[model samples]
Target chain A: MIEVNDLTKYYGQKRAISNVSFKVKKGEILGMLGPNAAGKTTAMRILTCYMPPTAGSATVGGYDIFDQSMQVRRITGYLPENPPLYTELTVKDYLMFVAKIKGVEKDKTKAEIDTVIEKASIGEVRNRVIGKLSKGFKQRVGLAQCLLNNPQVVILDEPTVGLDPKQIIEIRELIKNLKGDHTVILSSHILPEVEQTCERVVIISEGEVVAEDTPENLTARMKGGERVLLELEGDEKQVKEVFRTFPDVTAVKVNKTAGGLLKVEVESKKDLRKDYAQALIVKKIGLLEMQSDKVTLEDIFLHLTTKEEAA
Target chain B: MRKTLAIFEKEFKSFFYSPLAYVIIAIFTLITGYLFYNLLSWFVEQSFMMTMQAQQYRQAPPKFNVNLHLIRGYFGTLAFISLFILPTITMRLFAEEKKQGTLELLYTTPITELQVVTGKYLAGLALYIVLLIPTMFFMALLFIYGDPEFLPVLSGYIGLILLGSTFIALGLFISTLTENQIIAAIGGFALSLLLWIIGWGATFTGGTLKPVLEYLSILVHFEDFAQGVIDSTHVAYYLIFTIFGLYLSLKSIESVKWRT
Candidate 1:
């Protein structure tokens, strides 16, 4: 549960974030989608009470970031862009120290650490020195550190960056596992990662929120038209003539591919692949391949983030 | 108290996680031991020379006061040695945490700023104590063969610890100003050296400024403690100095959060 209202921050002459506002419902996984320097980290830092906002207010778990920052911090767990780690300390020692400062019960500190260590899958490396571990393990250790104190709100900044593909999948799964209990707000530049992991997406660009919706709703909202590709083994002259029978096809372009096949690209406002396929079948033409292209998440992101610049 | 001790435990233990702690302690012990040995041998040689002169002239030689000539002399050297060594312990206290980004962890947690500062300051004091332990052993050797006034020697230690606590406060404040360890060390040393010698200005200027400078000079107040006099004024001065340094450090840290 978090609420941010008209948050703005200025580092001297330069404005880092301006009039940024967002909210996370209890137990909801919210994705902060943006490119680098999109002020996502700045927004998260303000929420965590790491720094005060220049001209706005925010509350975490009903405790204001300014007036009751200690209470706000008690319920919030934050993993900064770089995992704040002591390279010399062992994993267990570091976790113990975090638990102590997080105000966990003295008798339960170990058990609580074990719980997060198991949750983040860092048990194997718990005894090893943290600095000697791999990047993925270090990131998991960071997650484990955030999980201490049984915090209700977990704010992670680019948790999957700089990891291998397999590690990325593992971390995404781990974050997904936090659902139903912890309200997660993760920031990332990766669109598909946000789409797959978050229940609600807030797309931010240039320090402002450009769009916010569910993945499917965002896709539907950004999907303006459709493009289809059809490859047929028939006469080029007949292919050019076949377009006349379809009244729905707004435009068509024919490309002559090698091996005597015609590549026909059809543009229309509706789905017409079945209609065209049947037409080709009735004409006794060999339908070799057909694939339709819908608007992808990347296109929507780029459009939303860049349209203001162009305007 | 729980939060303070948690931070104190971590900060104190982390020092030994590197070779630097062992090296600093060993080097300090060796240098002080060598200096103590030279002072003792010179004292013994001087006493023997006085006895020979008394036998030759049949008159009494000047009394060779062990507390004045030997233990006090060793303490004088130790006070300056601590000036050089104590800042190195404190220079890393806040600066390293800021550099490693661990201050974010502390700031974002439930711990208070006072708890964090006290934890770190205590760690620096602990290291100074450990550095002084072997010199205590060196002083125990004095009790084995000669009779030095035990209270004066103990008071001399009180002086050094007070002096060290003051230096740590000043150094901790300097450490809070920057993220660079080298700059923290050098800046802390330069400022501390300035405070240690501030009394010298009293000779050049006469009037209110002279007493003010003398009162402010950390070295001048330490003279009472080194002379085995636990004057409450000197104790109050060191305490106030220490508190002011801690207060400045707390403000610097708060400024970092607010300003940035």
Candidate 2:
């Protein structure tokens, strides 16, 4: 539904984003993961037709962002880093205004607003002035505004920033619920939130796409394979020798303690826990515990982003 | 067009949603009312003395034009009051949107920059017209107590509306330049005052420059309207000025996308 190719933007002489490119398929939830100043907001701004890019181009629903901006704007709904709201207006009034501007027909505006209000779970605060509402409620109102007119694509930048944990989870669940029906491009620095809600992610840093893949594929590619952490009560030298001699074992490190207890960390091309266990049993080496060490998305993000900086 | 009306409705309602609009209107009416009352008393006192002198000397009393004495004075005071009130009305038009981050919503919508500027400008014009409505009641007082020329009164109102709209368009343009409402208000007032007094420079200068200075002065065009004269030249001047101000506002709003 959206394609960004070699999109570059400059604010005066300073470059905000350079040659950044990514795509979102129809009905796919794509997360844009980047640290602060990674040009996440800049990219979203270009996509939403808020500003023109210095070079390259983007299209939403097959409408070029620059040449066909009106079409692009009509089909795409954006939630900026700060929710664009009028404090003086009531939630219902604000949404009604948004619906009108978004070109929702007059006959359908009220019904559409009620739909978004219910979808964003802001029904209780619909009649209250937005200024007096809590931040969470305000954020929900912002979200509800984006859902008006049944936009085909929704672009949200930092949707969960500055929210409490429970609110964050609720927002995450809400985003997860948008998976099949809407094409969503959500940008954030939070790794787990993206991991939990996004089907695919484009990890960006310093205004460039450093890595792009599914969450599981990213972590798997980061370590090359699984890692095993094992504790053994045996001769430390024998334990190390047994793991080193195993065929699929790539590397092993053993630490020997006072009571002949050995702590072993093994990295392998495949799962070797069972094979190692059999080897230890055949060798009469007493095994205390065995488990697989998981590589998280955080590690992969840091590795990729820092590697980009180093290069 | 529908989208522009939506924005217009929201902006117009926003003015009354706060105490700012009412407070400004109240202060404006009080000042104009006081000035009108004082003008009326002075006109009555002068006419009474004229009659006394005519009877004593066995001569005819001088004719007093109520439109000149009362209506002109009322409109002049209204123009001055508008210098203060119109800026306050327009200060929040774009500045508050920038301050509160609602400009993002405006920019991302399918509406063009021209529509946004026009919608906001019309809202400011509407508020200024509402502020002028009370002056009609003041005009009705003149009709009740004394006979006033209908054409002059009508011309005077047309002048006030035109002048007020010109100020509003200029104020709306100024509001787009900053996010601080105080700065917008003060800057708008300073610019309006400068334009209001620009014709003063024509008196001090000589040669070809005098006409140019006088032509640039807002008051020069408005003076004709105040005297119940609807010269096409003056009408054109205000129409051109209003369009110019709105044009600049549209350009300023479009520039925000690039500069920000």
Best lDDT among the predictions, by candidate number: 2
**TM value for model 1:** 0.95
Task: Encode model 2's per-residue lDDT on A8-93: one tens digit a residue.
Answer: 98988888889998889999999999999999999999999899999999999999999999999999889998999999999988
Top DockQ prediction, candidate number: 1
What lDDT does model 1 reach? 0.90
Span of 10 residues, lowest total lDDT, candidate 1 chain B = B218-227
| TM-score for chain A, candidates 1 onward in order | 0.92, 0.90
| lDDT per residue (tens digit) for residues B170-241 in model 1 | 999999999998999998899889998999999999988999999989888877777788998998898898
TM-score of chain B of each: 0.97, 0.98
Q: How many clashes in candidate 1?
A: 0
- What are the models' TM-scores? 0.95, 0.93
The first chain of model 1 has a TM-score of 0.92
Q: What is the lDDT of residue B45 in candidate 2?
A: 97
Candidate 1 vs. truth: CA RMSD?
2.2
Ten contiguous residues minimizing lDDT sum, candidate 2 chain A:
A255-264
